[model samples]
Target: MTINPLEYSAASHPGLMRDNNEDCFLSQPEHGLWLVADGMGGHEAGEVASAIVRDTIERETHENPAISLLDTIQHAHATILKSAAQGIGAPGMGSTVVALKSNSESYQVAWVGDSRAYLWTPSREGGRLERLSTDHSYVQMLVETGVIRAEDAEFHPEKNIITQCLGMQELPQVRVDFVEHQWHKDQWILLCSDGLTDEVNDKTIAQILFESNNCLAAVDQLLHAALTGGGRDNITLQIIESPLRDNPLRKGLWQWVPYLTGKTLVDAWIFGAALASLVSILFYVMYF
Candidate 1:
């Protein structure tokens, strides 16, 4: 059996403006499955929609490990629609979902509506924070058609108007978008709802991820940043790290050696001597 090497952290918040959280997340590192769902509708209906999406995918993926994530999401979509049709939730209830699946060799991301996925690579690996999924929203359409710049879409008046999502009555079938990439030990994958993106920009998110010592810290910092940014809507996020990579902060310590040594030659010599002694002790302990 191939042992899974994945570490992850997740968080969800109701935000400052909402009374209840209509967001849900799933993290099953052993299964290499992660997901985020943002619900739409008034009252408790939105919560019900998101919960259905979360539960359906979770159950389906667990039952059949080899099932495609695309099919799993489609199953969730049908479940949510059926629930609403059967009056389980309010009429017209729906949800946006973004999911990530990975194995020892590669990763795949799938999404619908404005929920998103991102990849962060460390500086040694070309240092990039990339968005892996596109929004299925009115603003995105406007941006694509050249009616508005991509930057302006964030603040567009109809930015929240999604073109597609799970459980929409008018649509007969949901459309899913997907992307695949080779998995690397030095990279991280992020799945999130629009709440975080609506408040925190991508640059700030990249900085937080870069500075964090581990997946848990990264998730905490990202959640704090979103709440600090006004917390206008329900917020949810997940950060998944590659288990093959050592602690990122430890790997990055060498970059701080010069700063730690200070400006003077004497300081550098002292620091070097201390580092050498520490290494000697570690070597002795290991060898003896």
Candidate 2:
């Protein structure tokens, strides 16, 4: 059977401290594109920077369906720079972006600054949460150079200091880091601003995502977690479920298999035992 249309959910929230949310996200399954942009500057300027990034990508992808994702992001970078130069937002308005684009068989993730992308596979499929993008921040640099442990970088005072982003007047062009992966039926992609990472640890994030019944639930839990964790910055995120179809037998079997205390492995074992018992009964009845 063919894969179904991609499933996705996105949200942006002004945290407990921030009165205004400067973060923005896009979910365009039609164009196979989704992204999160975190704005920086001050007040309205940050909002403008992120909004420009969102609008530019939305418009470009809608107008030119075949445009390269990289070229589209570059176009957004140029637009943001032009807007800042023309005094549209503020003198130093800029934004960090992380985006995902996909085709039928494969997908690509690209980013600048600390906004991140992660891949999650189910336990039955060698479950794990893998970070797909690296941060362009001073702390990240320090971590890379052995100045600090990766775990320590999270709480470091310089963690928020990003090295580059869209619309920086000092740089003529921004570099976008990217990676590609073959699509798998059991994989899910998550894109988020540092707002989520700053408040929630990777281990907690993986737990929430893996335990969630669907993308919407995962988004809700993640947002709630960040807000509870102090919500120091604007929180934004998107979760994209792969389009590939699950095994037909497993999908049908799950319909009658009740969750056993939210433990997937235990529930799976129960399902297998029940199936085997049913098969043995049918064989006995038919033969005797």
Candidate 3:
């Protein structure tokens, strides 16, 4: 017998008062994975880093859905380094990643840096949202040791100072969690960058999702609330829907981009193939 697919929903918010928004998201049912990346750097470098993370995740695992999560994330890290090597000052750019992989009743999460995933359940106080991913931030360390209250951690001036991120270091240590045993019927998973948590409170977020008709509307309402509350960064979100035999494109469209555009395709192949050859060395020395 075939098992039923699990429900999914997610949202991100950009907080009040910041210039360059640097967040990215992806949701694909074939792979049964979702991700969010929060990037940091000077100029538009933050965006570049975030896009690299998103692109790597989309490209690597989407092709072979049976691979292990650690292997996919490692591939993504390598790709990020390769992308950074193409730029002069990209060494300083980096991003934080949070990912979820689900199969029917159970889900596994992997994270590095400070982006978070939370699971919400019913409570006597009208339901509580439990933070599933721990922040790799300076403030988090302080809070963990009883040096500060959870409430104080929220208002701490150095709360945004995260200790880990993708592309910042050569090999980031990732924390993987198997949230296997605690599955619930109506629980919702929230994946977000710090921007949303920095602005609106958790209770409000829960209310919005609980009252909304569907996942899409829930995301829309979150964006609206964030903007109203004060949007300081770039915001991105994806709502995962149950897997269906909607299209064979689940595995096809992902790799077809190169073949679709002849000129672009030719250019990519030429670049990809020419690199690690005599031509790339000469080009790099002369121009780059």
Candidate topping lDDT: 2
Q: Where is model 2 poorest over a 10-residue stretch in terms of lDDT?
A: 252-261
Runs off by more than 4 Å, candidate 1: 1-4, 124-126, 246-288
For residues 219-288, write the lDDT of model 1, one tens digit per residue: 9999999999999999999998755574556656544445443444555677788889999999999999
True-structure lDDT of candidate 2:
0.90
lDDT of 3 by residue, 16-104 (tens): 55555678787766677888888888657777787788887778787777777666666666666767787733777888888878776
Candidate no. 2 TM-score: 0.88
List the candidates ranked by lDDT, beginning with the highest: 2, 1, 3
- The list of candidate 3 runs beyond 4 A from truth reads 1-20, 122-125, 170-182, 239-288
Worst 10 residues of 1 by lDDT: 254-263
